[model samples]
Target: MTPLAIAEHAPLFIVLNPASGRGEADNARRSIESACAQAGREHHIYQVDRHRRLQPCVQEAVERAKAVQGVVVAAGGDGTINAVAQATLGSGCAFGVLPQGTFNYFSRTHGIPTDTDEAMRVLLNEQPRAVQVGQVNDRVFLVNASLGLYAQLLEDREAYKAQFGRRRWVALWSALLTALRGHRPWYLHLSWHGVQRDIRTKTLFVANNALQLHQVGLPEADAPEQGQLAAIALKPLSTLSMLGLLVSGARGRLGEADSVVSFPFESMTVRPMRGHRRVKVATDGEIGWCAMPLEFRVSPEPLWLVRPAVAPELEATRQ
Candidate 1:
């Protein structure tokens, strides 16, 4: 269907996470409403009060708005977007983003405007486009799924942020430094695009698209468009080497590091060494401690999003 077709039929459901971006939902909602008024599109604002409650809210809202051609707009960061997108999969309800959360990785990758008014204008005026989604076991992720030290850092960062309001990167760095002191190599056995391989590494990331690793002065780019996943493995490095990798990443040359390896895959399964109890896993920026033996796969055509005009041309090229 054409962009105009989708807009004309769908009554937009804007889901705002008030806690995102340090409690900016009230301002975001007003701005969105103003944009809607200007565009003459009907919209309802729903605030997500809790993290796990998002799926049910999205499901119910989509069901209610189904007759009107529902489009669920996530007005927070990647976590909020991931939640709504996961629930709306295969439901024929297009997902839109307002990018109100910190480090909107999904929005940044897709070139969605971070500004509330600009994003709303794009949502009202842009076309709905299909994008691939990644699935690790039962959960859906729009950006990437990460395991190992980085994931642990994410878990810790969230906790620290809640307790102390420290910046996420600073918290992550502190956590990683602490975690690395006790870190051990993990065994990752997997098959990607029918090729079998094994690697023992300290960090493993399976990304739906390439991320401009912060502090690395590299041009930002999407993952390959073959609908395959990109995997990065980092061998255990000395504390100094790890810090150097961060520095190099900031300089945008992670591929140049001998400790980092990246490749493409269609799907894979990851398991930690035996007797490991709680390995960290993160989808988007949300982190959790999970048991070993997690299954991951690339879900073809799992989400439809409204793409802004300024978004990278590659998003428009997706089949």
Candidate 2:
């Protein structure tokens, strides 16, 4: 079917990941249902299997939502949101979210309420609008995607969270401790904006969402949706140097570290200079190995993200 008119009212189909927010997402279901009911919304909620693949379930839910103008709501962490968002791409389905995850980075970034009841009320009252998203190969990440140190940091953070529980600050602290053990740099060949460059850096962040940058306390990276993305690459550094970078970043002085550099671009291709055919990549808090010569670009078709009526900077980002 052709894409529906941009303002069509649709029934909400929420795909929730029960394991997100350390089972807090599951606990929030009653509140979600109650809010939906009180708001007089026709909504269906699904809890996908946590142990198995989520994309298929997400696809099926979005498919079933076609009758009501194909609106799907992702009700978990960034990973779950990413899956549903990717599936929504090109399907003409408007997507919404309830920030039931630890960080709720996407939710907070878009001015959606973090409280489930408030979020549902907002969802019930709003219509989806187009917004830009980043694509790396076949995957669409609602937040930033990265390789090298950031990927390892996500891996270590998840490990720590699985062991110590799913507190956002704790995950950050644990990742810091893991980074204290040191990191290795990868030589990369990056081609973007008609330039080819070489760099040995511990992490390369392709940021398209401002809140993710805010989470890292970078003022320069707070708005990546101006038709370009911010790419930051850090040169190899010792553990102490990394710590200094972190501390300086917390004080809004990331430029004080000489090993760091960043620029904005619409698209770029990155490949490890080392002869590896694939590398570990992290997207929206999900970690996995992706093939070499990765292509990262902002998708041409803007996703119709249904934001609350009072979304922060909605006017600014929709530009």
Candidate 3:
């Protein structure tokens, strides 16, 4: 299929979450408009704010794109992108990103650039490409989803982002503070790749994208491993040990530590042995409680996303 340029392509629709990136997304409206104007692309841009909900608006835009076989762009952070991506799933409409989020993990993992204008330029010029997608129950996550300490830390981290505001450093501080203040551990039963295991740990991290792991200081597989990797990480023995994990993680020495057990699988199912009706879960920086006996699986079918022509190795090879 021939790649569509922004100016001559079918109608383009963009969903912008104003709450994302600490009001940084608010200015994205003008940037997108300017970029589209420069490209002479006929597009509609929607802004999601406090009063109006996001899903319905995004759903409408995605439907319009599908009807016309155009494109829908999620111009916010990971959470916003999650909602928009779900809407675009199996719709046959091309999906694009602007990466106006704190980590922009999904965008970066797909080889989407962080710079707004550059990302738009890529979107305006490239074709949609296939990339793996992970699902937790019915919900989809582009980066990761986990229970145990990671979920609790994510909940706390959201609160900090709500109060102190955005950025990776804020999340880092929140995780550090949560560790230092003391976090309880729990037992989990996990079944994956035809094996079952019981483990006691503070955080259980199910990873789909390794790009962000490098940001936090963990060494991923030398070559591209499976799209879905599972790591059950134990908490620090003490506050001082938390510091050690931080330093070691940054240096990509986490595999050498006894605190984490890592494995690769096509998919996995996690059940908390504890008698809780719902378990706290974190998917791509979005924190929420999900019904127990969570099932995670990979969809090799891929999410059709727009990236630069010269995409990175990770995004370029999935198809």
Candidate 4:
């Protein structure tokens, strides 16, 4: 597909998450406004706070962008990006991002600058490129989705962030605490592309971001680029063993760990062998519950993401 014709005066509808990063939310808002004003671009900023929820704001932005043939931009963390992507994916409206998050796996993977000023420049000048996405049931996740112990870890990390503030150390500490506390292994029935197996695991993590997979030292890190999703399952382990596995992940050797099982798949279904109808799931760092059996697959259509232009050689390779 050709890139959208983003004229200089093209409207930009942005959905901003107030509580996304450690920086003041107002700062991001001002930065966005200042940039657009300097560029002479028409823009709309929708703030999502306690009173103004995310979904409605995203819906409004998507509708407005669709109406004017403008770009719908997500200006926050992965969760905020996921929400906006859910509304814009396959809607024929271009998607853009400003990385106001700690990890920023999605934006960084696509070469969107983390600096607000640089990101605004890219948003204004870049073209739309088709990007892969993952879906668990009806929910879209740009970075990852997981259940069992990994979901619990995300929940605990949020609690810690709420208390100690949002910092990398706080997230790491929460993971350590959660892992040390130990968790029950889930006996699950998993089927993927016609193969079925029963397994016991502490977590089932599905990754759609190559940057994140590569950071964790998974062999399937290139899966997303290859039009596939990577699944990582952790075998039952003692608390000490689990900590050891975490260390290996930190050192980027997770795929070499004995307790880890990693592979790439197009689609998968997971059901609890214990007859539970609901399970806690984490998608792009947001925690929620989903009724089993959970169906995870790569979305059939790619998301039209507005990002920096790829180099000629790399673009040809992607083709």
lDDT of each: 0.72, 0.78, 0.76, 0.88
Query: Each candidate: how many clashes?
Result: 12, 0, 3, 0
Q: Can you rank all candidates by lDDT, best first?
A: 4, 2, 3, 1
Residue-level lDDT of model 1, residues 259-301, one tens digit each, is 8877766678775545675666899878866666777777865
- Which is superior by lDDT, 3 or 4? 4
- Which regions of candidate 2 deviate over 4 angstroms? 1-9, 50-53, 214-223, 313-319
Name the lDDT of candidate 2.
Answer: 0.78
**Model 3: lDDT of residue 123:** 84
Estimate, for each residue in 83-174, the C-alpha lDDT of model 4 and write its tens digit: 89999998888899998887888998888888888889889888888899999999999999999899999999999999998899999999
List the pairs of residues colliding in candidate 2: none
Per-residue error for 275 in candidate 3, Å, reads: 1.3
Error of 3 at 294 (Å): 1.3
Query: Candidate 4 clashing pairs?
Result: none
Give the alpha carbon lDDT tens digit for every residue of 116-150 in model 3.
88888878888787767878888888788887777
Better of 3 and 4 by TM-score: 4
